[model samples]
Target: MHDFLVDLLICPKCYGELDWQIEQRSLNHIEKGEARCQVCHTSYPVQDGIGYFLLPDSGREDLWQEVDSHLVQHLQQNPEIEKRLMGVPLETLSPADQFFRAMVHEEREEFELAEESQSVANSGIYTDAYLSCWQSQTKYLMDRLASNDKPLIDLASGRGYLVEKLAQNHDFPIVATDFSPKVMRRNRRWFEYLGISDRVSLLAFDATKMPFKDASLEIMTSNLGLPNIKGPSELLHELRRVLAGRFMSITHFYPVDDNQNRELLRQANLETMLVRDLASAAFEQSGLQVEFTNICLSLAEPTPVGVVLEGAGIDALPVAETNLEWCLLEAQQSSKAKH
Candidate 1:
C-alpha cells in the first residue's frame, strides 16, 4: 500500500488511530507492514501492497461473485476437463459452455484469451437492449469520474469489469476493496499483468466495518456489488457514514411483479436492492439523497445450461424470462447530515 494512504485509514475494530510499522519498502510504497490500533491494540497486516483490515466476526460476504468456489475446485482436480474444453471449437459450443470455458481460462491465468471468450459468451446471453444499457452506464461513470481526482473506494469489487475500466481510463487513485484476501491477492496479480498495477490499491475489509474515518472518503463506487452483501441495512448506514461524496453504482433490478422470480429473490432476501422502491427507501433512510438514471429495460431469458460440460451447471441466473431494468444509482450524502 502507498504510505500516504495511512492517514485515510483507521482500525476497523475500534475506529482508533493506527501506529504503522513498515517492515519492507520499495520506492514510494510499503510492501509489507503491520498496523496496530493505538486504543484496542488489534493488528492488521499489509502484504504485497494490499492492506488487510478485515474483521474476524464480519457480517458480510461477496458470495455473489461470479466465479463459483465449487467449480474452481472441480476444475483443479480434473485437469483433463480444461484440455477437453479448450480443444473444442468455440464456434460450435453453447454460449453457456463458452462462458464456462472463459472462466476456466481465467482460473489458469490466461486473462487475454479469457476476455475474448467472455465477449463471445456475453453476445449470446445479453440482448442488445441490455448491452446498450450497460455501455451507457459505464460511459456515464467514466464521464463522471473525469471531473474528480480524489481517491475513490470501490466496495465489493469482486474483480468486476467496472473497476478495471476505471483504472485504465482515469488518473485518480482508486482503492478496490473486498472482504476476501484470496480475491484481493489474485486481483493484485491481475492488475500487474494488465500493466495498471500502479493505478489501484487493494484493501480487504468488510463493508459494515469500514476502516475509513467518518465522512473521510471523497468518492465511492460499485458495479452491481451492493445488492450482493448479506444484510445491507447496516452496510448502507456504514456507507453513508464514510462517504462525503456521491456513490455511483451501475446495477440492474429484476422485475418485482414477475412471480416466476419472486420466490427466488425473497428466498435470498434481496428485496432491498432488487425492488426499486425498497432500494431507494433503504438508501434514503440511511441519510443519502438517492436517485437512479439511465434507466432502460430488456428481455432476459434463461441462459442455456452447460451442454459441453454435460450440463454440470456452468453458473446460476434467473430460470425464467423477465424484463431486467438497468439503472445507474447515484446517492449523495444528505446536506442535513453534513451539519
Candidate 2:
C-alpha cells in the first residue's frame, strides 16, 4: 500500500510496469486505488490498504471473507484473547501464546479437534520423539533468522503467524502475501491491532506468478504451503524470477523410499519425492543453491489426519520426514549476501 511499493509491482497478466490511479490515501499508504498495466492494460485494485494482484479468475475470495467474519466474531466472544492481542502489542504476550490465541480465534473448531486428536496420539512414543526433533531444528532456524534483516516476503501466509512473530521480534519490514482477500484483510487488521502494521504489508497475489519484478526481492518464504501448490515447479520458477537473494520454506516431506512411509504417501495420493524433487529442480532453474535443510517438525505421534485415518483402520499414516525446518536457499545472483 505504500507509494514506494508501486516500484516493485508489475502486471500479473503481462508482467508490465503499471501506472497508479489513486482514489484514496492514508499518509504514505494508498488506502484505495487501481494499478493499470503499461503494456497489457490490465488493472489491479488496491483496497483496505492492501494491493490485489490476482488474476480475474482467482477463487476463494468469498470463502475467505466468510472465514474472516467468523474469526472476528470468535475473537469478540473471548475477552481474555481479545485483550491479550489488542493490548501492549509485543510486551503483553509471548510469540507462542499469541500464535495459539490467534489460531484459536481463527480456527476454533479445527483447533479443538486437533487438540483432542493430539491427546489421543500423544499416548504413543512417535509423537514425543517427533516433538523433540522438531524443537531442536526450529531452535536452530529461529537463531539464524533472528540475525537476518533482509526484506522478506512470506508467501501463503495463512493468518500471519510467522508475520506476527517476525514483526514483533525484528525491526525490518515484512511483506505477507496470500491469495485470499479475506485472509489478507484479517492480516492487515491483526497487524494494525498489534501495532506492527508499520512493519508489515499484506499483498494478494498468486504464488505461481507474483507481482514483484525480476530480482526485486531479497528473500521469499513459504511455510507448509508447498504441498498445497499443485505445480510447485512453476511457483519455484517464479520465485527465482523475482528473488535476488533466496527462497526459504518449511513443508511436510514424506519418506517415500521407505515402505511404511511410501504406503502413507499412497493413502494421501502424494509422492514422497514430489516436493523435494520439485524444489530441487525449481532452485536449479531459478539459479539458486540449496543452503540448509532441517527437520522442523518431528511427529512424535500421529497427526490429526493420521489419527483419523488410523482410527478408520488405515495403518499406514504419514510419519517419516514430517515437517522440514527452515530450509534456506541462496540465489546465485543475490545482491545482498547474509553474514
Candidate 3:
C-alpha cells in the first residue's frame, strides 16, 4: 500500500468511512459489503478487501476488481506468509523495511521460494527495469570516481546489480552484503557469470548490525535497499561508524515527508547535513561533511511491443505501461572536524 492510501482511509467520492471486512475472503466471489458515506449516502462496495469509493460500473472497477482478486488469491494461496506479513509491527519497522517486506512478500512468498526461481533471470519484467535504472546510476557513480581508488561497499545488496556493474569498469574492491544467504548465492552466481567473482565479495550481514570495523569504508551505497532495514536509526549509526569518508543511500518516501525521515535519523542520533528531495537525503548528522549531492533523472524503458506481444501472446493488447521514473539521487560524504 502506498502512503496516499494509508492516510486517506475514507471513500474518495462519498467521503465515507471505510472498514475492513474479514469474513468474505474469497477472490472469485465479489465480497458483498457497503461503505456508507456518513454525509452523502453514497454506498460503495467493499469487495475483495478493497474499499471502492468510485462510481459503480466506472472504468476503474475492472482495475480495482483485478487488484482485489489478486490480493485475495495471494492471501489464500499463502496464508502463512500473509500472517507473518500482517503480524509485523508497522510502527516499529522502519518505513523502508516495511516497504521492502511488502515487496518481498508480494513477489517471493515470504522469501520461501527457491533462489533460482526468485532470481532476476526468472522475472524478465523486473530484471529489465531494475538493471536499466541501476546501470544508469552505476555509470554516473563511475564518472565521479575519476581515478580514485576507494573501496566501495553495497549494504543490503541483493543480487549485486550495482556491484556487478561497477566491477565491469573499475578494479576497486567491492563488497556486497545481505542477510539472506539465498540472495547472496544468487549474487555470487551473477558475479561468476560476469567473470568478476574475484573483484566482488559477498557477505551475509544485517543492515542494523554490520560486521565491519570503525572508519573502514570509503564509500557505502544502498540502492532502495535500506528501507527494508529494521531499526533504521541504528542502521544509520552503524553506517556512520563504519564509514571513513562517505555514505550514500537511495531510499523511498515512506512514513512520508522529511520530518518522519529525520525523526528516525535523529532517534539514531544522526545529523543529516543535506537533503536532496523526498526520495533521498544526506546525513552529516554523524559529524560528517557533505562534499557533493547530485540529483539525476533515472528512467527505465518499457518492454518493446514485440517482446510484450510475444510474451503475452495477445494481439489485442491492453494499455500497457512501464515503471520508468526520474527520481535518482547521489551524495558524497567526508568526515567533519571535531570542535
- Each candidate structure's TM-score, on Cα atoms with residue i matched to residue i, is 0.92, 0.70, 0.46
- Mind giving the per-residue lDDT tens digits that candidate 1 earns over 1-339? 666679889998889999999999877677899999999999888888889898756643532344556666776777787666788788687788888888777777899988889999988866777778888889988988888989889999997577799989998888899888768877887888888778788899888789998888888999888877877898998898788778988988887688877677888787788878889989888889899987888787777777757776643556688898888899988777667
Model 2, span 29-145: residue lDDT tens: 788889999998888888888898988776656523444354357457866656655353433444333333434443443444334333333333245655455445445545657
Q: What is the C-alpha RMSD of each candidate to the true structure, in Å?
A: 3.1, 8.1, 20.0
| The candidate that achieves the highest lDDT relative to the unseen native structure | 1
Query: Model 1, stretches more than 4 Å misplaced?
Result: 59-69, 76-80
Local accuracy of candidate 3 as per-residue lDDT tens digits, 1-339: 111222223444443454433345333322344545555555555433333344443332242321333434655687775555445554343333343334445343343322322343223433354555545655666676657576677877876656766788888767677765445555555565568766665554466655455566677777667555565456666666666666665432222233644465446533222223322333445444533333333223233222211232211211233232322344333324333
Q: Is candidate 2 or candidate 3 better by lDDT?
A: 2
lDDT of 3 at 94: 33
> Where does the lowest 10-residue lDDT sum fall in candidate 1?
59-68
Question: With candidate 2 superimposed using the best TM-score fit, by how many Å does residue 223's alpha carbon deviate from the native?
Answer: 2.0
Q: Which lDDT value does model 1 have at 171? A: 88
* Candidate 3 Cα lDDT to native: 0.48
Pairs of colliding residues, candidate 1: 1-49
